[model samples]
Target: MNKAIVVTGTPATGKTTVAKAIANKLNLKYIDVNSLIRTHNLSEGYDDKMKCDIVDTDKLNRILKQMIKDSDQKLVIDSHLSHHLPKSYVELCIVTKCELKELKQRLEKRGYSKAKVRENLDAEIFDICRNEAKEKGHNVIVINTSEGSKDIDDVLEEFGFLKQFEA
Candidate 1:
Protein backbone atom coordinates (compact mmCIF):
# COMPACT_ATOMS: atom_id res chain seq x y z
CA MET A 1 0.00 0.00 0.00
CA ASN A 2 1.06 3.61 -0.49
CA LYS A 3 2.67 4.76 2.75
CA ALA A 4 4.59 8.00 2.72
CA ILE A 5 2.75 11.11 1.58
CA VAL A 6 4.28 14.58 1.39
CA VAL A 7 2.20 17.77 1.36
CA THR A 8 4.13 20.73 0.01
CA GLY A 9 3.70 24.10 -1.65
CA THR A 10 4.33 27.83 -1.38
CA PRO A 11 3.34 29.47 1.89
CA ALA A 12 -0.35 30.30 2.36
CA THR A 13 -1.34 27.47 0.02
CA GLY A 14 -3.35 25.40 2.55
CA LYS A 15 -0.75 22.67 2.88
CA THR A 16 -1.25 22.24 6.63
CA THR A 17 -5.03 22.23 6.51
CA VAL A 18 -5.17 19.70 3.68
CA ALA A 19 -2.41 17.55 5.14
CA LYS A 20 -4.13 17.33 8.51
CA ALA A 21 -7.44 16.49 6.87
CA ILE A 22 -5.85 13.68 4.88
CA ALA A 23 -4.11 12.31 7.94
CA ASN A 24 -7.33 12.37 9.96
CA LYS A 25 -9.32 10.69 7.21
CA LEU A 26 -6.73 8.02 6.52
CA ASN A 27 -5.67 7.30 10.11
CA LEU A 28 -2.12 8.13 9.16
CA LYS A 29 0.62 9.63 11.29
CA TYR A 30 0.67 13.40 10.68
CA ILE A 31 4.18 14.74 10.76
CA ASP A 32 4.68 18.49 10.81
CA VAL A 33 8.11 18.74 9.22
CA ASN A 34 8.75 22.24 10.57
CA SER A 35 8.20 20.93 14.09
CA LEU A 36 10.47 18.00 13.40
CA ILE A 37 13.16 20.37 12.12
CA ARG A 38 13.04 22.34 15.36
CA THR A 39 12.88 19.21 17.53
CA HIS A 40 15.86 17.70 15.76
CA ASN A 41 17.92 20.92 15.38
CA LEU A 42 17.94 20.39 11.64
CA SER A 43 17.96 24.07 10.73
CA GLU A 44 21.32 25.61 10.07
CA GLY A 45 20.09 29.09 11.00
CA TYR A 46 17.40 31.65 10.41
CA ASP A 47 17.15 33.53 7.15
CA ASP A 48 16.46 37.13 8.07
CA LYS A 49 15.83 38.10 4.48
CA MET A 50 13.26 35.39 4.06
CA LYS A 51 11.99 35.66 7.63
CA CYS A 52 12.25 31.89 8.09
CA ASP A 53 14.52 29.07 9.11
CA ILE A 54 17.39 28.08 6.85
CA VAL A 55 16.92 24.32 6.80
CA ASP A 56 19.52 21.99 5.41
CA THR A 57 17.51 19.81 3.07
CA ASP A 58 20.15 17.09 3.20
CA LYS A 59 19.93 16.87 6.97
CA LEU A 60 16.15 17.07 6.92
CA ASN A 61 15.92 14.21 4.40
CA ARG A 62 18.27 12.02 6.42
CA ILE A 63 16.16 12.48 9.54
CA LEU A 64 12.92 11.92 7.64
CA LYS A 65 14.29 8.73 6.11
CA GLN A 66 15.15 7.50 9.60
CA MET A 67 11.68 8.32 10.87
CA ILE A 68 10.11 6.48 7.95
CA LYS A 69 12.37 3.54 8.56
CA ASP A 70 11.39 3.39 12.22
CA SER A 71 7.66 3.81 11.74
CA ASP A 72 5.07 1.12 11.11
CA GLN A 73 2.20 3.47 10.37
CA LYS A 74 1.78 5.45 7.14
CA LEU A 75 3.05 9.02 7.29
CA VAL A 76 1.54 12.30 6.11
CA ILE A 77 4.45 14.73 6.08
CA ASP A 78 3.61 18.44 6.02
CA SER A 79 6.08 21.06 4.82
CA HIS A 80 7.06 23.06 1.75
CA LEU A 81 10.31 21.14 1.83
CA SER A 82 8.91 17.70 2.56
CA HIS A 83 8.95 17.00 -1.18
CA HIS A 84 12.72 17.09 -1.02
CA LEU A 85 12.76 13.54 0.24
CA PRO A 86 13.63 11.14 -2.54
CA LYS A 87 10.84 9.77 -4.72
CA SER A 88 11.72 6.30 -3.43
CA TYR A 89 10.80 7.42 0.07
CA VAL A 90 7.45 8.96 -0.77
CA GLU A 91 4.49 7.11 -2.18
CA LEU A 92 2.70 10.32 -3.14
CA CYS A 93 3.50 14.01 -3.26
CA ILE A 94 0.61 16.44 -2.93
CA VAL A 95 1.34 20.03 -3.95
CA THR A 96 -1.22 22.48 -2.60
CA LYS A 97 -2.01 25.54 -4.72
CA CYS A 98 -3.87 28.81 -4.29
CA GLU A 99 -4.95 31.54 -6.65
CA LEU A 100 -2.61 34.53 -6.68
CA LYS A 101 -5.14 36.96 -5.24
CA GLU A 102 -6.25 34.53 -2.56
CA LEU A 103 -2.67 33.74 -1.69
CA LYS A 104 -1.81 37.42 -1.39
CA GLN A 105 -4.69 37.92 1.01
CA ARG A 106 -3.63 34.92 3.05
CA LEU A 107 -0.06 36.14 3.38
CA GLU A 108 -1.14 39.63 4.36
CA LYS A 109 -3.67 38.25 6.82
CA ARG A 110 -0.89 36.27 8.42
CA GLY A 111 1.05 39.57 8.99
CA TYR A 112 3.84 38.72 6.62
CA SER A 113 6.12 41.54 5.50
CA LYS A 114 5.69 42.91 1.99
CA ALA A 115 8.91 41.32 0.81
CA LYS A 116 8.10 37.92 2.24
CA VAL A 117 4.65 38.07 0.70
CA ARG A 118 6.05 38.95 -2.69
CA GLU A 119 8.60 36.17 -2.52
CA ASN A 120 5.95 33.58 -1.83
CA LEU A 121 3.68 34.95 -4.52
CA ASP A 122 6.51 34.67 -7.00
CA ALA A 123 7.13 31.09 -5.95
CA GLU A 124 3.49 30.30 -6.60
CA ILE A 125 3.55 32.17 -9.90
CA PHE A 126 6.38 30.01 -11.10
CA ASP A 127 5.09 26.72 -9.68
CA ILE A 128 8.38 26.28 -7.89
CA CYS A 129 7.46 23.55 -5.42
CA ARG A 130 5.42 21.53 -7.85
CA ASN A 131 8.14 21.68 -10.48
CA GLU A 132 10.78 20.76 -7.94
CA ALA A 133 8.74 17.79 -6.70
CA LYS A 134 8.34 16.60 -10.28
CA GLU A 135 12.01 17.18 -11.04
CA LYS A 136 12.74 14.86 -8.13
CA GLY A 137 10.58 12.15 -9.71
CA HIS A 138 7.74 12.00 -7.16
CA ASN A 139 4.28 10.76 -8.00
CA VAL A 140 2.60 14.16 -7.84
CA ILE A 141 -0.92 15.47 -7.35
CA VAL A 142 -1.87 19.10 -7.67
CA ILE A 143 -4.55 20.16 -5.21
CA ASN A 144 -6.26 23.45 -5.86
CA THR A 145 -7.00 24.58 -2.34
CA SER A 146 -8.08 28.05 -3.36
CA GLU A 147 -11.41 26.86 -4.75
CA GLY A 148 -11.66 23.79 -2.49
CA SER A 149 -12.63 22.10 -5.72
CA LYS A 150 -10.82 18.89 -4.94
CA ASP A 151 -12.58 16.80 -2.35
CA ILE A 152 -10.53 14.95 0.22
CA ASP A 153 -12.30 11.72 -0.69
CA ASP A 154 -11.49 12.26 -4.34
CA VAL A 155 -7.86 12.77 -3.51
CA LEU A 156 -7.82 9.54 -1.54
CA GLU A 157 -9.54 7.79 -4.40
CA GLU A 158 -6.93 9.10 -6.80
CA PHE A 159 -4.22 7.82 -4.52
CA GLY A 160 -5.91 4.39 -4.64
CA PHE A 161 -6.89 4.51 -0.97
CA LEU A 162 -10.65 4.26 -1.44
CA LYS A 163 -10.55 0.48 -1.44
CA GLN A 164 -8.37 0.45 1.65
CA PHE A 165 -10.91 2.47 3.60
CA GLU A 166 -13.96 0.56 2.45
CA ALA A 167 -15.24 -2.03 4.88
Candidate 2:
Protein backbone atom coordinates (compact mmCIF):
# COMPACT_ATOMS: atom_id res chain seq x y z
CA MET A 1 0.00 0.00 0.00
CA ASN A 2 1.27 3.46 -0.89
CA LYS A 3 1.75 5.94 1.94
CA ALA A 4 0.27 9.43 2.03
CA ILE A 5 0.87 12.50 4.14
CA VAL A 6 -1.71 15.13 4.80
CA VAL A 7 -0.39 18.59 5.62
CA THR A 8 -3.24 20.53 7.16
CA GLY A 9 -3.62 23.78 9.04
CA THR A 10 -5.39 27.11 9.10
CA PRO A 11 -4.87 29.49 6.23
CA ALA A 12 -1.42 31.10 5.96
CA THR A 13 0.16 28.53 8.25
CA GLY A 14 2.74 27.40 5.62
CA LYS A 15 1.09 24.04 4.94
CA THR A 16 1.67 24.47 1.23
CA THR A 17 5.31 25.41 1.68
CA VAL A 18 6.06 22.45 3.92
CA ALA A 19 4.04 20.04 1.80
CA LYS A 20 5.90 21.11 -1.34
CA ALA A 21 9.26 20.79 0.39
CA ILE A 22 8.41 17.34 1.70
CA ALA A 23 7.24 16.22 -1.71
CA ASN A 24 10.45 17.46 -3.32
CA LYS A 25 12.64 15.86 -0.68
CA LEU A 26 10.85 12.52 -0.67
CA ASN A 27 10.13 12.38 -4.40
CA LEU A 28 6.42 12.19 -3.59
CA LYS A 29 3.56 13.72 -5.50
CA TYR A 30 2.43 17.08 -4.16
CA ILE A 31 -1.27 17.68 -4.31
CA ASP A 32 -2.59 21.11 -3.50
CA VAL A 33 -6.32 20.74 -3.04
CA ASN A 34 -6.97 24.44 -3.31
CA SER A 35 -5.09 24.65 -6.58
CA LEU A 36 -7.03 21.68 -7.90
CA ILE A 37 -10.29 23.33 -6.97
CA ARG A 38 -9.31 26.50 -8.76
CA THR A 39 -7.96 24.66 -11.78
CA HIS A 40 -11.20 22.75 -12.18
CA ASN A 41 -13.28 25.89 -11.71
CA LEU A 42 -15.27 24.05 -9.06
CA SER A 43 -15.62 27.05 -6.83
CA GLU A 44 -18.82 29.04 -6.77
CA GLY A 45 -17.48 32.42 -5.71
CA TYR A 46 -14.45 34.17 -7.16
CA ASP A 47 -14.34 37.59 -5.51
CA ASP A 48 -11.78 38.50 -2.90
CA LYS A 49 -14.27 38.42 -0.03
CA MET A 50 -16.15 35.29 -1.07
CA LYS A 51 -13.53 33.06 -2.59
CA CYS A 52 -13.48 30.51 0.24
CA ASP A 53 -17.23 30.52 0.55
CA ILE A 54 -17.48 29.40 -3.05
CA VAL A 55 -15.80 26.06 -2.48
CA ASP A 56 -18.15 23.09 -2.74
CA THR A 57 -17.06 20.77 0.01
CA ASP A 58 -18.75 17.69 -1.44
CA LYS A 59 -17.19 18.12 -4.85
CA LEU A 60 -13.86 18.83 -3.29
CA ASN A 61 -14.09 15.70 -1.19
CA ARG A 62 -14.99 13.61 -4.20
CA ILE A 63 -12.06 14.90 -6.20
CA LEU A 64 -9.68 14.34 -3.32
CA LYS A 65 -10.90 10.78 -2.86
CA GLN A 66 -10.38 10.12 -6.52
CA MET A 67 -6.92 11.54 -6.40
CA ILE A 68 -6.02 9.40 -3.41
CA LYS A 69 -7.31 6.29 -5.12
CA ASP A 70 -5.48 7.01 -8.35
CA SER A 71 -2.12 8.06 -6.96
CA ASP A 72 0.65 5.60 -7.90
CA GLN A 73 3.29 7.15 -5.64
CA LYS A 74 3.31 8.59 -2.14
CA LEU A 75 1.35 11.82 -1.86
CA VAL A 76 1.78 14.99 0.16
CA ILE A 77 -1.56 16.76 0.41
CA ASP A 78 -1.79 20.40 1.41
CA SER A 79 -5.23 21.51 2.44
CA HIS A 80 -7.16 23.14 5.26
CA LEU A 81 -9.54 20.25 5.89
CA SER A 82 -7.35 17.31 5.07
CA HIS A 83 -8.08 15.67 8.38
CA HIS A 84 -11.76 15.49 7.61
CA LEU A 85 -11.04 13.13 4.74
CA PRO A 86 -11.04 9.36 5.19
CA LYS A 87 -8.46 8.60 7.83
CA SER A 88 -7.74 5.11 6.53
CA TYR A 89 -6.31 6.59 3.35
CA VAL A 90 -3.81 8.79 5.17
CA GLU A 91 -0.60 7.34 6.52
CA LEU A 92 0.24 10.48 8.48
CA CYS A 93 -1.52 13.71 9.25
CA ILE A 94 0.42 16.81 10.18
CA VAL A 95 -1.11 20.03 11.37
CA THR A 96 1.14 23.03 10.82
CA LYS A 97 0.66 26.05 13.03
CA CYS A 98 2.08 29.52 13.68
CA GLU A 99 1.51 32.57 15.82
CA LEU A 100 -1.69 34.42 15.10
CA LYS A 101 0.10 37.70 14.53
CA GLU A 102 2.44 36.16 11.97
CA LEU A 103 -0.37 34.32 10.28
CA LYS A 104 -2.38 37.51 9.99
CA GLN A 105 0.57 39.32 8.50
CA ARG A 106 1.21 36.55 6.00
CA LEU A 107 -2.41 36.52 4.91
CA GLU A 108 -2.42 40.28 4.54
CA LYS A 109 0.71 40.14 2.46
CA ARG A 110 -1.01 37.61 0.24
CA GLY A 111 -3.77 40.19 -0.44
CA TYR A 112 -6.41 38.73 1.84
CA SER A 113 -8.84 41.17 3.37
CA LYS A 114 -8.99 41.98 7.07
CA ALA A 115 -12.04 39.77 7.48
CA LYS A 116 -10.38 36.76 5.92
CA VAL A 117 -7.21 37.27 7.91
CA ARG A 118 -9.07 37.55 11.19
CA GLU A 119 -11.20 34.52 10.38
CA ASN A 120 -8.12 32.42 9.76
CA LEU A 121 -6.39 33.70 12.88
CA ASP A 122 -9.44 32.94 14.94
CA ALA A 123 -9.61 29.46 13.46
CA GLU A 124 -6.00 28.85 14.37
CA ILE A 125 -6.42 30.08 17.90
CA PHE A 126 -9.45 27.85 18.34
CA ASP A 127 -7.41 24.88 17.09
CA ILE A 128 -9.89 23.96 14.43
CA CYS A 129 -7.45 21.82 12.47
CA ARG A 130 -6.21 19.99 15.54
CA ASN A 131 -9.74 19.37 16.70
CA GLU A 132 -10.69 17.95 13.35
CA ALA A 133 -7.75 15.58 13.37
CA LYS A 134 -8.54 14.40 16.87
CA GLU A 135 -12.17 13.90 15.99
CA LYS A 136 -11.10 11.71 13.11
CA GLY A 137 -8.93 9.56 15.37
CA HIS A 138 -5.80 10.45 13.47
CA ASN A 139 -2.37 10.57 15.03
CA VAL A 140 -1.94 14.22 14.20
CA ILE A 141 1.44 15.83 14.66
CA VAL A 142 1.46 19.53 15.43
CA ILE A 143 4.30 21.54 13.96
CA ASN A 144 4.86 25.11 15.06
CA THR A 145 6.23 27.39 12.39
CA SER A 146 6.39 30.52 14.50
CA GLU A 147 10.17 30.56 14.64
CA GLY A 148 12.04 31.23 11.41
CA SER A 149 14.84 28.79 12.24
CA LYS A 150 12.64 25.72 12.18
CA ASP A 151 12.67 24.01 8.78
CA ILE A 152 10.68 21.18 7.27
CA ASP A 153 13.51 18.75 7.98
CA ASP A 154 13.24 19.57 11.67
CA VAL A 155 9.55 18.77 11.61
CA LEU A 156 10.09 15.63 9.56
CA GLU A 157 12.71 14.42 12.00
CA GLU A 158 10.52 15.29 14.95
CA PHE A 159 7.74 13.27 13.35
CA GLY A 160 10.09 10.33 12.86
CA PHE A 161 10.34 10.62 9.11
CA LEU A 162 14.10 10.19 9.48
CA LYS A 163 13.52 6.69 10.83
CA GLN A 164 13.58 5.65 7.21
CA PHE A 165 17.25 6.63 7.15
CA GLU A 166 18.08 3.91 9.67
CA ALA A 167 16.58 1.16 7.57
Candidate 3:
Protein backbone atom coordinates (compact mmCIF):
# COMPACT_ATOMS: atom_id res chain seq x y z
CA MET A 1 0.00 0.00 0.00
CA ASN A 2 2.02 2.94 -1.22
CA LYS A 3 -0.87 5.39 -1.23
CA ALA A 4 -3.21 6.90 1.29
CA ILE A 5 -6.83 5.79 1.47
CA VAL A 6 -9.74 7.75 2.91
CA VAL A 7 -12.83 6.27 4.52
CA THR A 8 -15.59 8.85 4.48
CA GLY A 9 -19.36 8.88 4.69
CA THR A 10 -22.25 10.14 6.74
CA PRO A 11 -21.76 9.84 10.49
CA ALA A 12 -22.51 6.47 12.11
CA THR A 13 -22.18 4.75 8.76
CA GLY A 14 -19.17 2.72 9.99
CA LYS A 15 -16.53 4.94 8.43
CA THR A 16 -14.22 4.65 11.43
CA THR A 17 -14.87 0.97 11.92
CA VAL A 18 -14.25 0.10 8.28
CA ALA A 19 -11.25 2.41 8.05
CA LYS A 20 -9.60 0.92 11.13
CA ALA A 21 -10.24 -2.57 9.88
CA ILE A 22 -8.66 -1.74 6.53
CA ALA A 23 -5.66 -0.15 8.25
CA ASN A 24 -5.17 -3.18 10.49
CA LYS A 25 -5.52 -5.60 7.62
CA LEU A 26 -3.27 -3.69 5.28
CA ASN A 27 -0.74 -2.53 7.91
CA LEU A 28 -1.51 1.11 7.16
CA LYS A 29 -1.60 3.87 9.73
CA TYR A 30 -5.11 4.79 10.84
CA ILE A 31 -5.34 8.56 11.09
CA ASP A 32 -8.41 9.67 12.95
CA VAL A 33 -9.36 13.09 11.61
CA ASN A 34 -11.29 14.03 14.72
CA SER A 35 -8.30 13.41 16.94
CA LEU A 36 -6.10 15.32 14.55
CA ILE A 37 -8.42 18.29 14.78
CA ARG A 38 -8.22 18.24 18.56
CA THR A 39 -4.43 17.93 18.61
CA HIS A 40 -3.84 20.55 15.92
CA ASN A 41 -6.54 22.95 17.14
CA LEU A 42 -8.05 23.07 13.69
CA SER A 43 -11.56 23.58 14.94
CA GLU A 44 -13.04 26.99 14.37
CA GLY A 45 -15.75 26.31 16.95
CA TYR A 46 -18.43 23.87 17.94
CA ASP A 47 -21.68 23.68 16.02
CA ASP A 48 -24.14 23.21 18.85
CA LYS A 49 -26.98 22.52 16.46
CA MET A 50 -25.06 19.75 14.73
CA LYS A 51 -23.29 18.65 17.91
CA CYS A 52 -19.98 18.59 16.09
CA ASP A 53 -16.87 20.69 15.75
CA ILE A 54 -16.37 22.90 12.72
CA VAL A 55 -12.88 22.06 11.49
CA ASP A 56 -10.89 24.56 9.51
CA THR A 57 -10.36 22.62 6.27
CA ASP A 58 -7.37 24.57 5.07
CA LYS A 59 -5.42 24.07 8.29
CA LEU A 60 -6.47 20.48 8.60
CA ASN A 61 -5.39 19.72 5.03
CA ARG A 62 -1.96 21.21 5.64
CA ILE A 63 -1.47 19.21 8.83
CA LEU A 64 -2.66 16.01 7.20
CA LYS A 65 -0.40 16.46 4.20
CA GLN A 66 2.59 17.09 6.43
CA MET A 67 1.74 14.10 8.56
CA ILE A 68 1.50 11.93 5.46
CA LYS A 69 4.85 13.14 4.22
CA ASP A 70 6.48 12.69 7.61
CA SER A 71 5.42 9.09 8.01
CA ASP A 72 6.65 6.15 5.94
CA GLN A 73 3.46 4.22 6.53
CA LYS A 74 0.49 4.34 4.18
CA LEU A 75 -2.47 6.02 5.84
CA VAL A 76 -6.17 5.31 6.14
CA ILE A 77 -7.74 8.69 6.86
CA ASP A 78 -10.98 8.21 8.74
CA SER A 79 -13.30 11.18 8.48
CA HIS A 80 -16.23 12.53 6.57
CA LEU A 81 -14.03 15.53 5.94
CA SER A 82 -11.31 13.28 4.59
CA HIS A 83 -12.66 13.45 1.05
CA HIS A 84 -12.25 17.20 1.02
CA LEU A 85 -8.51 16.58 0.87
CA PRO A 86 -7.08 17.00 -2.59
CA LYS A 87 -7.23 13.89 -4.77
CA SER A 88 -3.48 13.95 -5.21
CA TYR A 89 -3.05 13.03 -1.56
CA VAL A 90 -5.38 10.05 -1.75
CA GLU A 91 -5.15 6.89 -3.82
CA LEU A 92 -8.52 5.51 -2.92
CA CYS A 93 -11.60 6.96 -1.26
CA ILE A 94 -14.06 4.58 0.36
CA VAL A 95 -17.58 5.57 1.35
CA THR A 96 -19.42 3.35 3.78
CA LYS A 97 -23.16 3.02 3.33
CA CYS A 98 -25.99 1.26 5.07
CA GLU A 99 -29.52 0.33 4.11
CA LEU A 100 -31.84 3.20 4.79
CA LYS A 101 -33.95 1.41 7.42
CA GLU A 102 -30.88 0.22 9.27
CA LEU A 103 -29.26 3.59 8.86
CA LYS A 104 -32.19 5.32 10.48
CA GLN A 105 -32.06 2.87 13.36
CA ARG A 106 -28.33 3.36 13.75
CA LEU A 107 -28.77 7.12 13.82
CA GLU A 108 -31.50 6.94 16.38
CA LYS A 109 -29.40 4.62 18.52
CA ARG A 110 -26.75 7.32 18.69
CA GLY A 111 -29.35 9.42 20.59
CA TYR A 112 -29.16 12.24 18.12
CA SER A 113 -32.02 14.69 18.02
CA LYS A 114 -34.72 13.89 15.51
CA ALA A 115 -33.55 16.78 13.42
CA LYS A 116 -29.96 15.54 13.42
CA VAL A 117 -31.03 12.06 12.48
CA ARG A 118 -33.05 13.42 9.60
CA GLU A 119 -30.21 15.59 8.48
CA ASN A 120 -27.74 12.71 8.48
CA LEU A 121 -30.24 10.44 6.80
CA ASP A 122 -30.74 13.00 4.10
CA ALA A 123 -27.00 13.27 3.62
CA GLU A 124 -26.78 9.53 3.17
CA ILE A 125 -29.75 9.37 0.87
CA PHE A 126 -28.26 12.10 -1.25
CA ASP A 127 -24.95 10.24 -1.46
CA ILE A 128 -23.02 13.24 -0.23
CA CYS A 129 -19.76 11.45 0.51
CA ARG A 130 -19.78 9.36 -2.63
CA ASN A 131 -20.67 12.32 -4.81
CA GLU A 132 -18.03 14.53 -3.23
CA ALA A 133 -15.35 11.91 -3.65
CA LYS A 134 -16.22 11.63 -7.33
CA GLU A 135 -16.21 15.41 -7.70
CA LYS A 136 -12.77 15.46 -6.09
CA GLY A 137 -11.52 12.98 -8.72
CA HIS A 138 -10.72 10.19 -6.30
CA ASN A 139 -10.81 6.51 -7.15
CA VAL A 140 -13.96 5.85 -5.16
CA ILE A 141 -15.38 2.63 -3.73
CA VAL A 142 -18.68 2.39 -1.99
CA ILE A 143 -19.24 -0.35 0.56
CA ASN A 144 -22.61 -1.17 1.97
CA THR A 145 -21.81 -2.50 5.40
CA SER A 146 -25.34 -3.68 5.78
CA GLU A 147 -24.48 -6.23 3.11
CA GLY A 148 -21.38 -7.82 4.71
CA SER A 149 -17.76 -7.40 5.64
CA LYS A 150 -16.80 -9.74 2.81
CA ASP A 151 -16.72 -6.75 0.50
CA ILE A 152 -13.93 -5.26 2.61
CA ASP A 153 -11.70 -8.26 2.03
CA ASP A 154 -12.40 -8.05 -1.68
CA VAL A 155 -11.43 -4.40 -1.70
CA LEU A 156 -8.14 -5.05 0.03
CA GLU A 157 -7.38 -7.88 -2.36
CA GLU A 158 -8.32 -5.82 -5.37
CA PHE A 159 -6.02 -3.04 -4.23
CA GLY A 160 -3.05 -5.46 -3.85
CA PHE A 161 -2.68 -5.11 -0.10
CA LEU A 162 -3.40 -8.75 0.73
CA LYS A 163 -0.21 -9.85 -0.96
CA GLN A 164 1.92 -8.67 1.95
CA PHE A 165 0.31 -11.23 4.21
CA GLU A 166 1.05 -13.97 1.71
CA ALA A 167 4.66 -12.85 1.45
**TM-score for each predicted model, relative to the true structure:** 0.90, 0.86, 0.89
Number of colliding residue pairs in model 2? 0
- Per residue, candidate 1 scores C-alpha lDDT tens digits across 1-167 of 34588999999898998888888877888999988988999888888878999999999999999888888888889999999999888988999999999999999999988999999999999999999999999989888887755566665556675336321
Taken over the whole model, the C-alpha lDDT of each candidate is 0.86, 0.79, 0.83
- Please rank every candidate by lDDT, starting with the best: 1, 3, 2
Superior candidate under TM-score, 2 versus 3:
3
Clashes of each: 0, 0, 0
lDDT of 2 at 12: 80
Instruction: Give the per-residue lDDT of model 3 (tens digit) for 9-127.
Output: 99988898789878878677899999888887888999888888988888888888887777778888999999988887888888999888989999999899888899999999999
lDDT tens readout by residue for model 2, 1-167: 46568889998888988888778777788898877987888878766673464677678877777778887777788988677777777878889899987888888899877788778888998999999888988878888888767577776666566345221
Question: Candidate 3: what lDDT?
Answer: 0.83
Model 1 gets an lDDT of 0.86
The regions of model 1 sitting more than 4 angstroms off are 148-167
Lowest summed lDDT window (length 10), candidate 3:
158-167
